[model samples]
Target chain A: MSGSSPGSIERLLGEREIVIACGPGGVGKTTTAAAAAAIAASRLGGDVLVLTVDPARRLADALGLKGLGNQVTPVPPEVFQAAGETPLGTLSAAMLDTKQSWDALIGEHAPDEATRDRILHNPLYQNITERFIQSHDYIAMERLYELHSSGSWDLIVVDTPPTRNALDFLDAPARLADFFSSRLLRWLIAPSRSTLLGIASKPFTQVADRILGTQFLADITEFFVSLQSMYDGFVERANAVSRLLADERTSFMVVSTSETVPLREAEFFATELATRGLDIGAVVLNKVLPTSLSDPDALAATRRLAQRTPEMTAALAARLDVDASVLDRVLETVTESFEDFAVVARREASSRERFPLGGATLLTVPQLDRDVHDMEGLLTLGSYLLGS
Target chain B: MIPLAERSLIFVTGKGGVGKTSVAAGLAQMLAFQGRSVLGCEVDAKGDLAAAFEAPPSGFTPVSAGENLSLMAMDTEASLREYLKLNLKIPIIGRIGPLARAFDFVATAAPGVKEILTVGKLCYEVRERHYDTVVVDASATGHIVGQLAAPQAINELVKVGLIRSQTDWMLDILSDPRQCGLVIVTTPEEMPVAETVELAAKVAEETTVELAAVVVNRVLPERFSPRAEAVFDRLSSHEGIDALSEVLGADSASVVGAAALATTMRRSRVQHMNTLRAGLPAGTPLVLVPYLFQRADGHRATRQLALHLAEEIDR
Candidate 1:
């Protein structure tokens, strides 16, 4: 079983250079990642960047910025100052532009200008970059590698794309290789009648040409053959990305709430991370029901108070010569409120017990009465996360 | 009301952790109960719908999960093989393990191919008239728009081929409102509601899939009447607290604390519900699924949601 005491997230923030926050959607994973980066920059004295690709754009609004794009923009010092914190280091953030990153990756690796233009302008490649299922996943890893290699930030926090797709980023390299190494491309790209291999594939080509019209085959062959020179670069980059993710300095953090579904996703994420041989640093359990009222003595006291409510109301009514029914209604409402909290607190605790991160650090963030949408809110969350 | 039986496919989607799977399962059961042969399907999902329906875990082929309901979990690899076998009529290649693996690798690498195959298979089921309804517990809201648009996007790239033909059929099924529609699930919260509204607009812009209804899950019940609210307000006032304190003595603090918490909870719930309604597209049908205060059990809770949907659909 995981220990009951919440572990310090500040310690991990100070120690790890790369923190990847992964979890199901709607669990505030992006906000938690952004808060971690902001705190690490202001309180711990290090340059930090929080990279997010969330379509919801909550992170941008939370940071009080009008918008974010592919470019890494510095978070104005005034924002931090307004929250009563002066940053000793720099805090910058960016949202990944999927297509721009894909275009850039190709531009940097293509063998020549002609190859680059051919692939860039190819209708099929254009469709692939825009509509490919894993383009977002692959480009996210590509950008992370680029930033990590740039060596500007002392610490970087990644707000991974939500849910299972985030896991797709973890295995992107292998999947990318599988796509490139498949024999189908070889058959498609085979030179026409120049070698014995070409003659051997003639029948297959005929069938393919018939099924997918001659023009279709020609387009596909052009798309694949144009990239033949840059295939090696893509493969090597994929391998480098995999290595970067598995590096000792990289840590994976799972963010979740104490709901049954989110906890299940947390456990699944932790298990997947472990299976990938990556380091699991901490699990941030957010919006946990308040534990203050969960204590046995407190529960007994509240129960006794509820039981004595009618008597107390009667005595008050007699002393003040007021309507007893008004007091009675008010007393019942107050007592029921406490009882509701108690029930929720107990339910949340039981749900938390089902999370399976026994050996990993556990950090719990209590639910706030108001929604967080500003720097002050982030810092307040930071204090709770860092236990300061 | 959108007729569930008339549609060949229903794509249920929402932001994660908002009970999309439960809503899909409940809708499946409700449709099944109405004497329609329904197939509950999930793509790249972890047997959640299967467990919710208390059915055997699904494989590539649809299996009986309940009366009038069959279940299948679609994957890129399996759907790719199925697609190849159906399109190319090559049984030997699909039977050869290594050959099948190679095809799977090729399909995996190609972007939009997996999504096309998955959607294609669902469309294929409808075209074959195998089931009265195919309910897909689709991907999360963030990616579902892209998934739905993949086939048409690919069709634009490949103009003349078997691939184009297949994608055209898939698009046909998706664009026809009587054949296909979408059910968006959400919670009475700010982010989910906002996402749901944006998703509705995106779907309307990107695809022909019509919005069947918005299912609001975990809606907190209204607990206070206007009279009770006024009374609670008076009790919380300073002079009122002092007067009550004189009689209640030391117990006044506990009572006051409880009152504050209760007020906070009730106020937030009302705030969230109002936000949800305001953010949604006007005149969109809303199904209110109450918050189950008890611990959540997949099967039982799904049934509760199904019962609710049944009533809503009947109304």
Candidate 2:
């Protein structure tokens, strides 16, 4: 991994159990993670699974999975063979259906038929189940742990959400556990124990009569009323998920660009992971600008050409178009704008240089000329990841 | 051509999270104080505009935060609901609420859909002339590109309808330099500075809207004098160390910190002003806002920002 070149991010996938890829939106985390998995499975002949939580389904499309759900879909043998230079190993992929997972969790936890139906059918519950708050994240974690424990794959690569909120996906199990264990849930379910409710006699009996005018609040109360029976069960599951995350085998990777915001986010996330006592294995900086020019002489020539724009403009106007004033004006503008052009070109060159962030073994990948859309692109990315 | 007074929409957008909302609210407050009608719009779901005005999170409905400025959250749900009803020809039955909610859910769920909704709402406000100015706290560079591109996306996705027509109208407004302009906000940091340059190029390629100005915010104070560095160096030397250590031992960390602070300040100031100069077209004014000790959250801070903006605009 240390010997990996300036342009690629290498992975010792045989050694590590879990690899988490995280970064800000549009930084190519999904593609990078997929490529790494592809590399591991192809080059190393190790079974690999890539799990993506991005609702965008970019990874699903990249993997050529028709419709990805909670269930793992094995990549076609040919696809894996094509992606690797050597005989490829097995590849499986899944896109997490957070909502479906939540429903399944509830069904497993519900105390009775009435409670299960009440919880499952509620609109607010459905909405929240899909939202950031619910155990969608916890469920995803549980699925990852299940896959890892099953020994079905040698390497499991997880592509997390793009925003700073990606941390929430990892932290969700503990958060849900805290929410369940907190006094708030108890107060919501058994209002008799609540101090404020104790002051107001017949609180549970008068719940409906207290506030009916506000339709939104009433709708919310009704939604919770139906979900109450399964509350304790949900809490217990959340606790189990939290313990699963506490396992030492899982490692968090902070994915970022060389740019400030993503790098800053990675730094902040590192601090957060440290606070949570989670071990951060590595930091992968994707889409890093290359330091050296492909053609320094050509670049210098362009700089000179930009400087002698006036002569170029005169020559262009004389030969190309006498009557085309617009063309002549454009030529003249270009001639005068050579210095500005040189500045831009220089900046573009400098932007490629390594952005040194100390205390992290940074793996930087060069900016891709094309967008990642299919298995071929992922393969090319995989080669680059290993080569670099 | 409509008179300046009648051309009531002032759409303010720049690179994301660069205090565009603060600038918008400040501008609105200034305009409102001058007895002009103003509405501050937060097209982004983050609702930073409302935060700037110290107003409660709101949606669609403009809530007055002050005498002149009213803040609106621009509810994407409501916008999607109305859009579906009018454009998609969805029936307004109670059952449609679920469908509408689904659409809202899908729209929110879609990558860059929030941006589309934000721009859509903003364009609607502009076209309707709802206020004297609709200063949109738009999404940052990449997102704003998506926002501006949404009309074309919708135009291509939806063949012919009010949505298409509305999208067309918004595109016109966005593309017309006279009607709308893009104001870029940047900090002195390398990434933001670099992003600003890239964003300017991208925006120029996509739209005819003029680059109004680059607002360089939170510029640190220049504290290092030429003599101060020499004095500090001399004090640290062995010849002056005994006397200096007695006098400045406790304040050494502060001095070093101050020195580092000065270096950072100088670097930032130079980088910011240089980036602004380099990125912006020549003669495009660069507004430098001094760093405030406190966060720009409260009304007092916003008012100060407004005053600073007024000064910059005048200059």
Highest-TM-score candidate: 1
TM-score, cand. 2: 0.54
Residue pairs that clash (backbone atoms under 3 angstroms), model 2: A4-A388, A5-A388, A8-A388, A289-A352, B8-B132, B16-B140
Sorted into a CAPRI-style docking class, model 2 comes out as incorrect
Candidate 1 per-residue lDDT, tens place, A1-388, comes to 2345657777778988899988877888888888888888889978898898763445586564455468888888998998889998888888888889888988998989999999899877776777655777888888998999999988899988764555887887777866676666665566742543363355545444544456655655677787777888888888899999999999988999888777776788789899989998888888876665566655665565566656777776665455688767666767676676677777778777777774667888877777666778788887778877
Worst 10 residues of 1 chain B by lDDT: B101-110
DockQ of 2: 0.03
Give the range of the ten consecutive residues with the poorest summed lDDT in model 2 chain B. B248-257
Off by over 4 Å in 2: A1-12, A55-59, A131-136, A162-164, A191-233, A293-359, B1-315
Error of 1 at A8 (Å): 1.2
Q: Which candidate has the highest DockQ of all?
A: 1
What DockQ do you compute for every candidate structure? 0.45, 0.03
CA-lDDT, candidates in order:
0.76, 0.59
